[model samples]
Target: MSLRKRLIACLDMTDGRVVKGTRFADLVDAGDPVGLCLRYAADGADEIVILDIGATVDARPALLALISRAAAVLDIPLAVGGGVRSYDDAAAFLDAGADKVSINSAALADPALVSRIAQRLGSQSVVVAVDAAAHEGSWRVRSVAGTLETGRDAVAWASEAVERGAGEILLTSIDRDGTRSGYDLQLTRAVADAVRVPVIASGGAGSAADVIAVLREGGASAALLASLLHFGMVRLPELKARLAESGVEVRRPLPAPRPEEVAAWRG
Candidate 1:
Protein backbone atom coordinates (compact mmCIF):
# COMPACT_ATOMS: atom_id res chain seq x y z
CA MET A 1 0.00 0.00 0.00
CA SER A 2 1.16 3.54 -0.70
CA LEU A 3 1.44 6.30 1.83
CA ARG A 4 -1.73 8.23 2.46
CA LYS A 5 -1.92 11.14 0.04
CA ARG A 6 -1.88 14.54 1.72
CA LEU A 7 -4.27 17.46 1.26
CA ILE A 8 -2.48 20.76 1.61
CA ALA A 9 -4.01 24.24 1.51
CA CYS A 10 -2.20 27.08 -0.24
CA LEU A 11 -2.60 30.69 0.83
CA ASP A 12 -1.13 33.14 -1.64
CA MET A 13 -0.48 36.42 0.12
CA THR A 14 0.18 39.97 -0.99
CA ASP A 15 0.95 42.55 1.66
CA GLY A 16 -0.01 40.18 4.46
CA ARG A 17 -3.46 39.48 3.04
CA VAL A 18 -4.65 36.30 1.35
CA VAL A 19 -5.23 36.79 -2.36
CA LYS A 20 -6.09 34.68 -5.41
CA GLY A 21 -5.53 35.31 -9.05
CA THR A 22 -5.97 33.65 -12.40
CA ARG A 23 -2.82 32.41 -14.12
CA PHE A 24 -0.97 34.33 -11.39
CA ALA A 25 -2.57 37.64 -12.41
CA ASP A 26 -5.72 39.66 -11.70
CA LEU A 27 -5.44 39.51 -7.96
CA VAL A 28 -8.49 39.45 -5.73
CA ASP A 29 -8.86 39.35 -1.98
CA ALA A 30 -9.53 35.93 -0.50
CA GLY A 31 -9.35 36.23 3.27
CA ASP A 32 -7.00 36.61 6.20
CA PRO A 33 -3.98 34.33 5.85
CA VAL A 34 -3.66 33.54 9.54
CA GLY A 35 -7.37 32.93 10.00
CA LEU A 36 -7.55 30.78 6.89
CA CYS A 37 -4.50 28.83 7.97
CA LEU A 38 -6.14 27.95 11.24
CA ARG A 39 -9.45 27.14 9.57
CA TYR A 40 -7.83 24.88 7.06
CA ALA A 41 -5.90 23.03 9.74
CA ALA A 42 -8.96 22.57 11.91
CA ASP A 43 -10.87 21.40 8.86
CA GLY A 44 -8.19 18.73 8.28
CA ALA A 45 -5.66 20.14 5.87
CA ASP A 46 -2.55 17.97 6.23
CA GLU A 47 -0.25 20.91 5.69
CA ILE A 48 -0.40 24.67 5.18
CA VAL A 49 1.69 26.59 2.62
CA ILE A 50 1.88 30.37 2.77
CA LEU A 51 3.64 32.09 -0.11
CA ASP A 52 4.29 35.83 -0.13
CA ILE A 53 3.80 36.31 -3.86
CA GLY A 54 5.09 39.86 -3.90
CA ALA A 55 8.06 39.40 -1.62
CA THR A 56 10.47 38.51 -4.39
CA VAL A 57 9.40 41.25 -6.75
CA ASP A 58 9.42 43.90 -4.05
CA ALA A 59 12.95 42.84 -3.07
CA ARG A 60 11.95 42.15 0.49
CA PRO A 61 12.13 39.21 2.81
CA ALA A 62 9.57 36.48 3.34
CA LEU A 63 6.72 37.77 5.50
CA LEU A 64 8.21 36.48 8.72
CA ALA A 65 5.68 38.23 10.93
CA LEU A 66 2.77 36.81 8.93
CA ILE A 67 4.39 33.40 8.89
CA SER A 68 4.91 33.51 12.63
CA ARG A 69 1.28 34.41 13.20
CA ALA A 70 0.04 31.61 10.98
CA ALA A 71 2.47 29.13 12.44
CA ALA A 72 1.25 29.91 15.92
CA VAL A 73 -2.27 28.88 14.93
CA LEU A 74 -1.42 25.98 12.66
CA ASP A 75 -1.54 22.52 14.16
CA ILE A 76 -0.19 21.01 10.95
CA PRO A 77 3.16 21.71 9.33
CA LEU A 78 3.65 25.24 8.03
CA ALA A 79 5.71 25.87 4.89
CA VAL A 80 6.77 29.44 4.09
CA GLY A 81 8.28 30.67 0.83
CA GLY A 82 8.94 33.77 -1.26
CA GLY A 83 12.11 35.89 -1.27
CA VAL A 84 14.16 33.14 0.38
CA ARG A 85 17.46 34.15 -1.18
CA SER A 86 20.06 32.92 1.30
CA TYR A 87 20.71 30.62 4.23
CA ASP A 88 19.95 33.42 6.69
CA ASP A 89 16.65 34.13 4.99
CA ALA A 90 15.61 30.52 5.26
CA ALA A 91 16.90 30.35 8.81
CA ALA A 92 14.87 33.36 9.83
CA PHE A 93 11.68 31.73 8.59
CA LEU A 94 12.46 28.59 10.56
CA ASP A 95 13.43 30.53 13.63
CA ALA A 96 10.26 32.58 13.46
CA GLY A 97 7.82 29.70 13.01
CA ALA A 98 7.94 27.76 9.75
CA ASP A 99 8.47 24.02 9.87
CA LYS A 100 9.80 24.05 6.29
CA VAL A 101 11.04 26.82 4.02
CA SER A 102 10.45 26.74 0.26
CA ILE A 103 12.87 28.34 -2.17
CA ASN A 104 11.97 29.13 -5.77
CA SER A 105 13.66 31.74 -8.00
CA ALA A 106 16.53 32.13 -5.58
CA ALA A 107 17.26 28.43 -5.80
CA LEU A 108 17.28 28.70 -9.57
CA ALA A 109 19.63 31.68 -9.42
CA ASP A 110 21.97 29.89 -7.00
CA PRO A 111 21.45 26.17 -6.93
CA ALA A 112 23.89 25.96 -4.03
CA LEU A 113 21.50 27.93 -1.85
CA VAL A 114 19.29 24.88 -1.51
CA SER A 115 22.15 22.73 -0.26
CA ARG A 116 23.36 25.46 2.07
CA ILE A 117 20.00 25.78 3.74
CA ALA A 118 19.50 22.04 3.83
CA GLN A 119 22.92 21.50 5.36
CA ARG A 120 22.05 23.81 8.21
CA LEU A 121 18.39 22.93 8.77
CA GLY A 122 18.27 19.38 7.44
CA SER A 123 16.85 18.41 4.04
CA GLN A 124 13.41 17.71 5.47
CA SER A 125 13.15 21.36 6.44
CA VAL A 126 13.68 22.50 2.87
CA VAL A 127 11.11 22.35 0.08
CA VAL A 128 12.06 23.47 -3.43
CA ALA A 129 9.15 25.12 -5.21
CA VAL A 130 9.02 24.97 -9.00
CA ASP A 131 6.57 27.16 -10.86
CA ALA A 132 6.26 25.94 -14.43
CA ALA A 133 4.44 27.22 -17.48
CA ALA A 134 3.74 25.22 -20.61
CA HIS A 135 6.03 26.31 -23.41
CA GLU A 136 6.38 24.66 -26.80
CA GLY A 137 4.81 21.45 -25.50
CA SER A 138 7.24 21.30 -22.58
CA TRP A 139 7.06 22.92 -19.18
CA ARG A 140 9.63 25.61 -18.38
CA VAL A 141 10.33 26.94 -14.91
CA ARG A 142 9.00 30.38 -14.06
CA SER A 143 10.46 32.74 -11.50
CA VAL A 144 9.75 36.07 -9.80
CA ALA A 145 6.22 35.02 -9.05
CA GLY A 146 5.69 33.44 -12.48
CA THR A 147 6.72 36.56 -14.40
CA LEU A 148 10.13 35.47 -15.72
CA GLU A 149 10.68 32.25 -17.64
CA THR A 150 13.98 30.62 -16.69
CA GLY A 151 14.01 28.31 -19.73
CA ARG A 152 14.64 25.40 -17.36
CA ASP A 153 12.75 22.18 -17.77
CA ALA A 154 10.45 21.59 -14.82
CA VAL A 155 11.26 17.90 -14.47
CA ALA A 156 15.00 18.45 -14.78
CA TRP A 157 15.03 21.23 -12.21
CA ALA A 158 13.00 19.10 -9.80
CA SER A 159 15.49 16.22 -10.03
CA GLU A 160 18.45 18.58 -9.60
CA ALA A 161 16.84 20.34 -6.68
CA VAL A 162 16.35 17.01 -4.94
CA GLU A 163 19.96 16.05 -5.64
CA ARG A 164 21.08 19.26 -3.93
CA GLY A 165 19.33 18.28 -0.68
CA ALA A 166 15.74 19.38 -1.20
CA GLY A 167 13.59 16.85 0.64
CA GLU A 168 10.37 17.61 -1.22
CA ILE A 169 9.03 19.44 -4.28
CA LEU A 170 6.19 21.95 -4.40
CA LEU A 171 5.35 21.90 -8.10
CA THR A 172 2.87 24.51 -9.30
CA SER A 173 1.54 24.79 -12.86
CA ILE A 174 1.64 28.39 -13.98
CA ASP A 175 -0.78 27.86 -16.80
CA ARG A 176 -3.24 26.00 -14.66
CA ASP A 177 -2.95 28.21 -11.61
CA GLY A 178 -6.23 29.57 -10.28
CA THR A 179 -8.05 28.13 -13.29
CA ARG A 180 -9.92 25.41 -11.41
CA SER A 181 -9.68 23.16 -14.46
CA GLY A 182 -7.61 20.43 -12.76
CA TYR A 183 -3.95 19.72 -12.14
CA ASP A 184 -1.52 19.21 -14.99
CA LEU A 185 -1.35 15.45 -14.68
CA GLN A 186 1.40 14.87 -17.22
CA LEU A 187 3.66 17.53 -15.76
CA THR A 188 3.12 16.26 -12.21
CA ARG A 189 3.68 12.61 -13.20
CA ALA A 190 6.90 13.48 -15.02
CA VAL A 191 8.42 15.31 -12.06
CA ALA A 192 7.09 12.84 -9.52
CA ASP A 193 8.60 9.97 -11.49
CA ALA A 194 11.94 11.71 -11.96
CA VAL A 195 12.36 12.76 -8.33
CA ARG A 196 12.83 10.54 -5.28
CA VAL A 197 11.26 13.03 -2.89
CA PRO A 198 7.57 13.65 -2.46
CA VAL A 199 5.90 15.96 -4.99
CA ILE A 200 3.01 18.17 -3.98
CA ALA A 201 0.83 18.89 -7.00
CA SER A 202 -0.49 22.45 -7.15
CA GLY A 203 -2.61 24.69 -9.40
CA GLY A 204 -5.96 24.00 -11.08
CA ALA A 205 -7.83 22.29 -8.30
CA GLY A 206 -11.59 22.73 -8.87
CA SER A 207 -13.34 20.07 -6.86
CA ALA A 208 -12.95 17.03 -4.63
CA ALA A 209 -12.95 14.87 -7.75
CA ASP A 210 -10.08 16.95 -9.08
CA VAL A 211 -8.13 16.22 -5.90
CA ILE A 212 -8.75 12.50 -6.33
CA ALA A 213 -7.72 12.65 -9.97
CA VAL A 214 -4.46 14.40 -9.19
CA LEU A 215 -3.51 11.98 -6.43
CA ARG A 216 -4.50 8.88 -8.41
CA GLU A 217 -3.79 9.64 -12.05
CA GLY A 218 -1.18 12.34 -11.65
CA GLY A 219 0.98 10.13 -9.39
CA ALA A 220 1.33 12.93 -6.86
CA SER A 221 1.97 12.30 -3.18
CA ALA A 222 -0.13 15.34 -2.28
CA ALA A 223 -2.38 18.05 -3.73
CA LEU A 224 -2.34 21.77 -2.94
CA LEU A 225 -5.61 23.60 -3.12
CA ALA A 226 -6.33 27.32 -3.29
CA SER A 227 -9.35 28.68 -5.20
CA LEU A 228 -11.82 25.97 -4.36
CA LEU A 229 -11.04 25.91 -0.69
CA HIS A 230 -10.70 29.66 -0.43
CA PHE A 231 -13.96 30.30 -2.21
CA GLY A 232 -15.89 27.76 -0.10
CA MET A 233 -16.53 25.60 -3.15
CA VAL A 234 -15.25 22.49 -1.37
CA ARG A 235 -14.25 21.80 2.20
CA LEU A 236 -11.44 19.52 3.36
CA PRO A 237 -13.71 16.88 4.80
CA GLU A 238 -15.71 16.72 1.58
CA LEU A 239 -12.54 16.27 -0.39
CA LYS A 240 -11.23 13.52 1.89
CA ALA A 241 -14.54 11.70 1.70
CA ARG A 242 -14.43 11.82 -2.07
CA LEU A 243 -10.88 10.51 -2.13
CA ALA A 244 -11.77 7.69 0.26
CA GLU A 245 -14.65 6.62 -1.95
CA SER A 246 -12.34 6.60 -4.94
CA GLY A 247 -10.13 4.07 -3.15
CA VAL A 248 -7.36 6.54 -2.48
CA GLU A 249 -5.84 6.29 0.97
CA VAL A 250 -6.26 9.66 2.70
CA ARG A 251 -6.08 11.10 6.19
CA ARG A 252 -9.76 11.11 6.99
CA PRO A 253 -10.93 14.11 8.97
CA LEU A 254 -13.58 14.20 11.67
CA PRO A 255 -17.13 14.43 10.40
CA ALA A 256 -18.41 17.92 9.77
CA PRO A 257 -21.89 18.89 10.82
CA ARG A 258 -24.42 18.99 8.03
CA PRO A 259 -25.96 22.35 7.09
CA GLU A 260 -29.38 21.48 8.48
CA GLU A 261 -27.83 20.04 11.62
CA VAL A 262 -25.94 23.29 12.15
CA ALA A 263 -29.03 25.37 11.51
CA ALA A 264 -31.15 23.33 13.90
CA TRP A 265 -28.45 23.32 16.54
CA ARG A 266 -28.09 27.07 16.20
CA GLY A 267 -31.84 27.55 16.75
Candidate 2:
Protein backbone atom coordinates (compact mmCIF):
# COMPACT_ATOMS: atom_id res chain seq x y z
CA MET A 1 0.00 0.00 0.00
CA SER A 2 1.13 3.55 -0.63
CA LEU A 3 2.37 5.35 2.46
CA ARG A 4 1.72 8.70 0.81
CA LYS A 5 -0.81 10.62 2.91
CA ARG A 6 -3.79 12.09 1.08
CA LEU A 7 -4.70 15.75 0.88
CA ILE A 8 -8.44 16.19 0.29
CA ALA A 9 -10.39 19.31 -0.60
CA CYS A 10 -13.75 19.73 1.15
CA LEU A 11 -16.52 21.79 -0.47
CA ASP A 12 -19.45 22.44 1.81
CA MET A 13 -22.54 23.18 -0.25
CA THR A 14 -25.83 24.88 0.48
CA ASP A 15 -28.42 25.43 -2.25
CA GLY A 16 -25.91 24.19 -4.82
CA ARG A 17 -23.33 26.79 -3.89
CA VAL A 18 -20.02 26.27 -2.12
CA VAL A 19 -20.03 27.91 1.28
CA LYS A 20 -18.28 27.58 4.62
CA GLY A 21 -19.25 28.58 8.12
CA THR A 22 -17.52 29.00 11.43
CA ARG A 23 -18.32 26.10 13.69
CA PHE A 24 -21.18 25.16 11.29
CA ALA A 25 -23.00 28.47 11.33
CA ASP A 26 -22.88 31.90 9.76
CA LEU A 27 -22.11 30.39 6.37
CA VAL A 28 -20.85 32.56 3.54
CA ASP A 29 -20.28 31.86 -0.10
CA ALA A 30 -16.90 30.51 -1.10
CA GLY A 31 -17.32 29.62 -4.80
CA ASP A 32 -18.97 27.32 -7.25
CA PRO A 33 -18.67 23.67 -6.27
CA VAL A 34 -17.98 22.29 -9.71
CA GLY A 35 -15.35 24.88 -10.52
CA LEU A 36 -13.61 24.36 -7.19
CA CYS A 37 -13.70 20.58 -7.55
CA LEU A 38 -12.20 20.74 -11.03
CA ARG A 39 -9.51 23.12 -9.88
CA TYR A 40 -8.58 20.91 -6.95
CA ALA A 41 -8.44 17.84 -9.16
CA ALA A 42 -6.11 19.61 -11.57
CA ASP A 43 -4.07 21.01 -8.71
CA GLY A 44 -3.19 17.51 -7.37
CA ALA A 45 -5.81 17.08 -4.64
CA ASP A 46 -6.00 13.33 -4.01
CA GLU A 47 -9.78 13.45 -3.64
CA ILE A 48 -12.72 15.81 -3.33
CA VAL A 49 -15.38 15.66 -0.61
CA ILE A 50 -18.56 17.54 -1.48
CA LEU A 51 -20.98 17.86 1.41
CA ASP A 52 -24.45 19.36 1.26
CA ILE A 53 -24.20 20.85 4.72
CA GLY A 54 -27.77 22.11 4.68
CA ALA A 55 -29.50 19.18 3.08
CA THR A 56 -30.43 17.48 6.32
CA VAL A 57 -31.90 20.63 7.78
CA ASP A 58 -33.69 21.57 4.58
CA ALA A 59 -35.16 18.09 4.19
CA ARG A 60 -33.64 17.82 0.74
CA PRO A 61 -31.76 15.02 -0.92
CA ALA A 62 -28.08 14.75 -1.70
CA LEU A 63 -26.76 16.97 -4.48
CA LEU A 64 -27.01 14.49 -7.34
CA ALA A 65 -26.78 17.05 -10.13
CA LEU A 66 -23.73 18.64 -8.59
CA ILE A 67 -22.11 15.27 -8.05
CA SER A 68 -22.74 14.31 -11.68
CA ARG A 69 -21.27 17.55 -12.95
CA ALA A 70 -18.21 17.28 -10.69
CA ALA A 71 -17.67 13.61 -11.57
CA ALA A 72 -17.69 14.46 -15.27
CA VAL A 73 -14.71 16.77 -14.86
CA LEU A 74 -12.90 15.02 -12.04
CA ASP A 75 -10.47 12.20 -12.75
CA ILE A 76 -10.04 11.69 -9.03
CA PRO A 77 -12.49 10.09 -6.63
CA LEU A 78 -15.58 11.98 -5.49
CA ALA A 79 -17.28 11.46 -2.14
CA VAL A 80 -20.75 12.98 -1.71
CA GLY A 81 -22.84 13.17 1.44
CA GLY A 82 -25.49 14.96 3.48
CA GLY A 83 -29.16 13.92 3.83
CA VAL A 84 -28.32 10.40 2.84
CA ARG A 85 -31.03 8.69 4.93
CA SER A 86 -31.35 5.20 3.59
CA TYR A 87 -29.70 2.45 1.58
CA ASP A 88 -31.48 3.66 -1.54
CA ASP A 89 -30.29 7.18 -0.88
CA ALA A 90 -26.71 5.94 -0.61
CA ALA A 91 -27.07 3.83 -3.76
CA ALA A 92 -28.49 6.75 -5.68
CA PHE A 93 -25.45 8.82 -4.84
CA LEU A 94 -23.12 6.07 -6.05
CA ASP A 95 -25.11 5.75 -9.27
CA ALA A 96 -24.93 9.51 -9.69
CA GLY A 97 -21.17 9.36 -10.24
CA ALA A 98 -20.00 9.45 -6.66
CA ASP A 99 -17.10 7.06 -6.08
CA LYS A 100 -18.13 6.89 -2.45
CA VAL A 101 -21.18 7.91 -0.43
CA SER A 102 -20.70 9.53 2.97
CA ILE A 103 -23.33 8.97 5.63
CA ASN A 104 -23.65 11.17 8.69
CA SER A 105 -26.91 11.71 10.56
CA ALA A 106 -28.47 8.71 8.91
CA ALA A 107 -25.71 6.44 10.10
CA LEU A 108 -26.11 7.74 13.61
CA ALA A 109 -29.86 7.20 13.55
CA ASP A 110 -29.57 3.75 12.10
CA PRO A 111 -26.17 2.14 12.26
CA ALA A 112 -27.48 -0.62 10.01
CA LEU A 113 -27.37 1.78 7.06
CA VAL A 114 -23.58 1.71 7.08
CA SER A 115 -23.41 -2.06 6.88
CA ARG A 116 -26.15 -2.22 4.28
CA ILE A 117 -24.41 0.28 2.05
CA ALA A 118 -21.10 -1.50 2.42
CA GLN A 119 -22.67 -4.88 1.75
CA ARG A 120 -24.32 -3.57 -1.39
CA LEU A 121 -21.71 -1.18 -2.71
CA GLY A 122 -18.64 -2.54 -0.91
CA SER A 123 -17.06 -1.14 2.23
CA GLN A 124 -14.46 0.71 0.18
CA SER A 125 -17.27 2.86 -1.20
CA VAL A 126 -18.60 3.90 2.22
CA VAL A 127 -17.29 6.85 4.20
CA VAL A 128 -18.72 7.65 7.63
CA ALA A 129 -18.58 11.31 8.66
CA VAL A 130 -18.41 12.19 12.32
CA ASP A 131 -18.86 15.83 13.22
CA ALA A 132 -17.77 16.06 16.82
CA ALA A 133 -17.50 18.92 19.28
CA ALA A 134 -15.80 19.02 22.65
CA HIS A 135 -18.32 18.76 25.43
CA GLU A 136 -17.69 18.55 29.17
CA GLY A 137 -14.12 17.35 28.84
CA SER A 138 -15.05 14.81 26.15
CA TRP A 139 -16.13 14.92 22.53
CA ARG A 140 -19.76 14.36 21.61
CA VAL A 141 -21.10 13.49 18.15
CA ARG A 142 -23.26 16.14 16.54
CA SER A 143 -25.61 15.73 13.61
CA VAL A 144 -28.31 17.50 11.61
CA ALA A 145 -25.99 20.19 10.39
CA GLY A 146 -24.36 20.09 13.83
CA THR A 147 -27.40 21.39 15.64
CA LEU A 148 -28.10 18.21 17.54
CA GLU A 149 -25.78 16.56 20.00
CA THR A 150 -26.22 12.82 20.26
CA GLY A 151 -24.11 12.58 23.42
CA ARG A 152 -22.17 9.75 21.85
CA ASP A 153 -18.50 9.58 22.60
CA ALA A 154 -16.57 10.48 19.47
CA VAL A 155 -13.95 7.73 19.61
CA ALA A 156 -16.48 5.06 20.52
CA TRP A 157 -18.70 6.09 17.62
CA ALA A 158 -15.76 5.90 15.24
CA SER A 159 -14.95 2.37 16.31
CA GLU A 160 -18.60 1.38 16.03
CA ALA A 161 -18.84 2.87 12.54
CA VAL A 162 -15.89 0.80 11.44
CA GLU A 163 -17.44 -2.31 12.88
CA ARG A 164 -20.58 -1.48 10.92
CA GLY A 165 -18.54 -1.56 7.67
CA ALA A 166 -17.42 2.01 7.19
CA GLY A 167 -14.14 1.82 5.33
CA GLU A 168 -12.99 5.29 6.29
CA ILE A 169 -13.82 7.93 8.85
CA LEU A 170 -14.15 11.63 8.03
CA LEU A 171 -13.61 13.22 11.43
CA THR A 172 -14.43 16.91 11.54
CA SER A 173 -13.76 18.93 14.68
CA ILE A 174 -16.74 21.20 15.06
CA ASP A 175 -14.87 23.34 17.54
CA ARG A 176 -12.12 24.16 15.07
CA ASP A 177 -13.97 24.25 11.75
CA GLY A 178 -13.48 27.41 9.74
CA THR A 179 -11.55 28.99 12.60
CA ARG A 180 -8.14 28.24 11.03
CA SER A 181 -6.87 27.86 14.56
CA GLY A 182 -5.52 24.34 13.90
CA TYR A 183 -6.87 20.82 13.90
CA ASP A 184 -8.01 19.32 17.19
CA LEU A 185 -5.14 16.86 17.45
CA GLN A 186 -6.50 15.44 20.69
CA LEU A 187 -9.84 14.63 19.09
CA THR A 188 -8.28 13.43 15.85
CA ARG A 189 -5.74 11.22 17.59
CA ALA A 190 -8.40 9.72 19.80
CA VAL A 191 -10.61 8.73 16.89
CA ALA A 192 -7.67 7.65 14.72
CA ASP A 193 -6.40 5.39 17.45
CA ALA A 194 -9.85 3.92 17.97
CA VAL A 195 -10.32 2.95 14.36
CA ARG A 196 -8.14 0.73 12.20
CA VAL A 197 -9.48 2.33 9.00
CA PRO A 198 -8.11 5.52 7.52
CA VAL A 199 -9.18 8.72 9.26
CA ILE A 200 -9.40 11.96 7.28
CA ALA A 201 -8.85 14.83 9.71
CA SER A 202 -11.06 17.78 8.88
CA GLY A 203 -11.69 21.30 10.24
CA GLY A 204 -8.94 23.75 11.30
CA ALA A 205 -5.93 23.99 8.99
CA GLY A 206 -4.42 27.47 8.88
CA SER A 207 -0.93 26.46 7.73
CA ALA A 208 0.95 23.60 6.15
CA ALA A 209 2.44 22.74 9.51
CA ASP A 210 -1.02 22.11 10.92
CA VAL A 211 -1.61 19.41 8.31
CA ILE A 212 1.81 17.86 8.88
CA ALA A 213 1.18 17.78 12.59
CA VAL A 214 -2.10 15.91 12.11
CA LEU A 215 -0.58 13.37 9.72
CA ARG A 216 2.60 12.81 11.69
CA GLU A 217 1.45 13.18 15.27
CA GLY A 218 -2.35 12.79 15.25
CA GLY A 219 -2.04 9.52 13.28
CA ALA A 220 -4.40 10.55 10.53
CA SER A 221 -4.05 9.01 7.09
CA ALA A 222 -5.30 12.16 5.37
CA ALA A 223 -6.18 15.79 6.01
CA LEU A 224 -9.28 17.56 4.74
CA LEU A 225 -8.88 21.20 3.80
CA ALA A 226 -11.53 23.89 3.47
CA SER A 227 -10.89 27.50 4.52
CA LEU A 228 -7.21 27.19 3.67
CA LEU A 229 -7.84 26.22 0.07
CA HIS A 230 -11.17 28.03 -0.41
CA PHE A 231 -9.87 31.40 0.62
CA GLY A 232 -6.49 31.27 -1.26
CA MET A 233 -4.53 30.99 1.96
CA VAL A 234 -2.42 28.17 0.50
CA ARG A 235 -2.20 26.45 -2.85
CA LEU A 236 -2.33 22.66 -2.88
CA PRO A 237 1.00 22.22 -4.64
CA GLU A 238 2.74 24.61 -2.28
CA LEU A 239 1.28 22.81 0.72
CA LYS A 240 2.30 19.39 -0.62
CA ALA A 241 5.83 20.59 -1.31
CA ARG A 242 6.07 21.91 2.22
CA LEU A 243 4.87 18.59 3.61
CA ALA A 244 7.33 16.62 1.48
CA GLU A 245 10.14 18.85 2.67
CA SER A 246 9.13 18.01 6.22
CA GLY A 247 9.49 14.25 5.49
CA VAL A 248 5.83 13.47 4.86
CA GLU A 249 5.22 11.10 1.93
CA VAL A 250 2.84 12.58 -0.62
CA ARG A 251 1.79 11.98 -4.19
CA ARG A 252 4.28 13.35 -6.70
CA PRO A 253 3.99 15.57 -9.79
CA LEU A 254 3.62 18.62 -7.54
CA PRO A 255 4.00 21.68 -9.70
CA ALA A 256 7.11 23.78 -9.25
CA PRO A 257 6.11 26.90 -7.36
CA ARG A 258 6.62 30.27 -9.00
CA PRO A 259 9.09 32.54 -7.29
CA GLU A 260 6.34 34.91 -6.23
CA GLU A 261 4.15 32.14 -4.83
CA VAL A 262 7.13 30.68 -3.02
CA ALA A 263 7.82 34.03 -1.45
CA ALA A 264 4.16 34.43 -0.58
CA TRP A 265 4.10 31.04 1.13
CA ARG A 266 7.20 31.92 3.09
CA GLY A 267 6.03 35.40 3.88
Q: Per-residue lDDT of 112-208 in model 1, one digit per residue for the tens?
A: 9999999989999999999999888889999888899798999899999999999999999988987889999999989998998999999998878
Residue 88 in model 2: shift from native, Å? Answer: 0.8
lDDT of 1: 0.86
Q: Which pairs in model 2 have colliding backbones?
A: none
Q: Which candidate's lDDT is highest?
A: 2
Tens digit of lDDT per residue, candidate 2, span 76-137? 99998888889988888888899998899889999998999999899999999999999888
Q: Compared to the true structure, candidate 2 yields what TM-score?
A: 0.87
Overall lDDT per candidate, in order of appearance: 0.86, 0.87
What's the alpha carbon RMSD for model 1? 7.0
Query: For every candidate structure, what is the RMSD over all alpha carbons to the true structure, in angstroms?
Result: 7.0, 7.5
Cα error, candidate 2, residue 161 (Å): 0.4
Error of 2 at 260 (Å): 35
State, as a TM-score between 0 and 1, how close model 1 is to the true structure.
Answer: 0.87
Model 1 error, position 33 (Å): 1.8
